[model samples]
Target: MIRDILYTLDSPYRAPLEITGFRFGKGEKTVAIVGAIRGNEVQQLYICSQLISKLRALEAKGAITSDNEILVVPSACPYSMNIGKRFWAVDNTDINRMFPGYDRGETTQRIADGLFQHVRGYSYGIQFASFYMPGDFIPHVRMMETGFQSTSLANLFGLPYVLVRHPRPYDTTTLNYNWQMNQTNAFSVYTNQTDRIDEVSAKQAVDAVLRFLSRIGVVRYHCHNGFLASVIDEDQLYSITAPDGGIYRGICHPGDEVTRGDLLGEILDPYTGDVRAPVVSPTEGIVFFGYAQPLVMEHAILYRIIRRLHG
Candidate 1:
């Protein structure tokens, strides 16, 4: 394994900020995996570190195939990570929203530019991504429906779900969308948690990546055939929102099955502890995501369910 700084910038108050990458095997630029663009994405970072560890063992044993290379970048924004901030510490900007970025633009843009330069042109690009909201997701492989997206390729990861999302205006600036536009097969792997490490899901993610690599002949690792992924469009999800701002009390979690009108959660008055609203399922389906935080605002999305289809 070869460890190198992928990009670096001078810091006025402290040490230079560096984005590091670990390279395994030699030859073709087969795959690039990124993790933790946001500081709070502890799970994403953990998954990448575990991937690096596993790749190191595979490389040491000559398990990595010749003529194929894999790059694992564990963290891109360590400065924010150091302070436990979610975005850039100085400007409160998101590195993820500055992709395919401008070299002469703001700090996050510059960092994105430098990093994208190094990661682009790979056969595949995989990002361990977190949700925009505080929630838990059923582990899935998500792709942007950028015309270049291939659900068949996404299924190789073997995750339980393959979500194809339609890109909005702001999505054009994201790493996954830009990678797809640039001819790279890009995928975003979402595990259950963002801020905290979930070992079970992390192992599932690592094994899924290994399974993909082995299936593509990049490595010789053996792993079980994961789920035959259920391909779902992002629009198909049923979103349940909080009716009033209050303390949230959720009874169901991601991956739970619920029937129509089932009690998913309830909102209580922050001071009085009286029930403010009861959140219920509108359709029989699997919980794809559930808000994990204890407090919520009115109209805040509480759950996203994958509505079951009848025969």
Candidate 2:
């Protein structure tokens, strides 16, 4: 099927937001995948568009078919996307934070309302993007404690790691939280940092989704080798912070693997160029993330060591 442009929200003051997607096959297992709810996440939009294109090609060749509908909204916030910002033009509110939105609310709220309304009928939902957190990413799925279905889907996504997050009561209005709360199942998969997007991370994400859809019978392509069956809890994370305030330098880049007590970085006295103290790894693990900037504060996170034993 040729992909369709469902609706375009025009802005006389700026460029319009285009909601584009494709639907294929027919059955009870409808799925909705959205990306770039935050405007600045162009990488996610591009990657989701790529996925959409590939799925369309496969569907046309009869190489792919879904038991249920698959709806993909590749770029959700066009105005923010056009401006390369993360918030709506009207109030600068985060659309993701204002989910299950009211129809008569602000512009972004209206957009959220529309998305929530559209996705509610689906059996499963996924929101993909790069996050605002610092440093390189280790692919992970974030879920609310909705039920076993959320857990199963998170495992099925096959990311290198999984984060089983609890939806803080305050976060109950978020897309995933609200959907899960209302008996609809949804999960979020993402890389770290909205500002930096890498090809490796993007490819990993697409691979994860390919496997997920395959398992769900959304497509026929399957690669069992890519799945990472373990789920990582918040406790598994260990942070290595700077001991003193100084000009900081990291010994390893994000995504590098290391053993316990490995040298992570160092702090230097800015004026004298003297070594302040070395920041050592807290545990044997991969440097999943860290601060990229050269400056530091006492207790600033110089590196995030996700214990190797967990992997």
Candidate 3:
């Protein structure tokens, strides 16, 4: 196992932000796995750490294929993580949104640029990503509809679901989208937690990546057969929003199957202790995301259901 610094940013008031990567085997850059671009993504970083340990063991056993190199970057924004901030500490900007970045641009952009310079040409790229909102959900592999995405390729991860998201204008600047634009097949892997750690889903994520590496001939590790994976479009999810800001109680959790008109959750008036709104399922399907936080705001997304496909 070889450890190297992929990028660095000096700080006068704090330790230099160092993006470090671990390399296993030698030759072609077959795959690159990144984690924790945002500070709050503790689960993502933990998953990558577990993966690195697994890879180190595999490397010791000569399990990695010859002429195949894999890079694992555990975290990209350590400064924010140190301070428990979600974005760049200085500017409050997202590194992910800068993408194929500019060296002469802002701090986050330069960090993005420096990182991208080192990771771009790999055959496959995997990012352990977190959701924009805080919630617990079924683990899935997500891909951008960048005209270069392949559900078949994504299924190799063997996760339960594959989400193909249509890119909005802002998505053009994201790492996953830009990676595809540069002819590299990239995927974002989401586990069940973010700020907190869940052992089951973390192991599941590590196993999924190992499965993919084995399938792609990069490693000799044998793993359990994961799901065949159901593909869903991002726009097709049935979203349930909170009717009013209040204390929330979700009866249904992620991966739970619900029937149409089922009372999935309820919102209570914090002051009156009365049920103010009952969130219901409109269609029969699995809950992809379930509200986990105790509080909710009016019109905030509470649930996103994946409707079952017909024969």
Candidate 4:
């Protein structure tokens, strides 16, 4: 395993912060895997570490295919992680939103620029991504609907779902979108949680990456076939919103199958224990995402369900 310091930011009063990459093998076709871009993505970092460990063992055993390079970056924004902030601690900006960036621009942009320069032009790019809102998600692989996107390529991971998202204007600056614009095939892998680690899902994520590597001829490790993977577009998801603000008492979790009008959860009065609103499923489907926060705000999105298309 070769450790490369891809980018470094000097601290005014402390040690310089570095974005490090652990590279394996030497070759023309490269696969770049990125872990945590945000500070609070504990599960993302943990999954990458497990991937790195497995890759290291495979490398020692001569399982990695010759001339195929794989790079795993465990953490990119360590400063924010150390300080317990989500975005760049200095300017409160997201490094992910500044991708394919400018070296002479702001701090986060420069960091993004420096990192992008090193990882671009790869055969495949995998980012262990986190959701913007705090919640739980079923393990899936997501791709922006860039003209270059290939759902067949995403299915190699064998995750439960392959989500194709229509990119908004702001998405043009994101790493995955920018990578596709630059002629690289990029996909984002979303595990179950963000701030905390879930061992089952983390291992599932690691196995998915290994499965991809094996399928692409980068590695020769034997592994089980993950999932057949359902391909879904973002618009097909039905969102359930909270009607009143109060303490959330969730009865349904992500991955649960629910019938239409089933009682999913209830918002309760914090002091008196009276139910403020009873949240129910609007359609027969599987839960794709569930709001995990204990407190609920009025009109906030509480759940996203993948509705069945047929009766």
TM-score of 3: 0.98
User: lDDT of each model, Cα atoms only?
Assistant: 0.94, 0.74, 0.93, 0.92
Backbone atom clashes (below 3 Å) for every candidate:
0, 2, 0, 0
Model 4 Cα lDDT, one tens digit per residue, 1-311 = 89999998898987998999999998874799999999998889999999999999999999999999998889989888888999998789999999998999998999999889988989899999998877888999999998999899899999989999999988889899988998889999998889899999999999999999999999998999888899999989999999999999999998999999999999999999999899988899999999999998998889999998794
What lDDT tens digits, residue by residue, belong to model 2 across residues 58-81?
Answer: 677775664567778887787777
Worst 10 residues of 3 by lDDT: 129-138
Q: Candidate 2 regions off by >4 Å?
A: 2-12, 27-29, 244-247, 253-255, 269-273, 297-299, 308-311
Candidate number with the higher lDDT (1 or 2): 1
Question: TM per model?
Answer: 0.98, 0.86, 0.98, 0.98
Look at candidate 1 and give me any clashing residue pairs.
Answer: none
Badly placed stretches (over 4 Å) of model 1 are: none
Using lDDT as the yardstick, the better of models 3 and 4 is: 3
Error of 3 at 128 (Å): 0.3
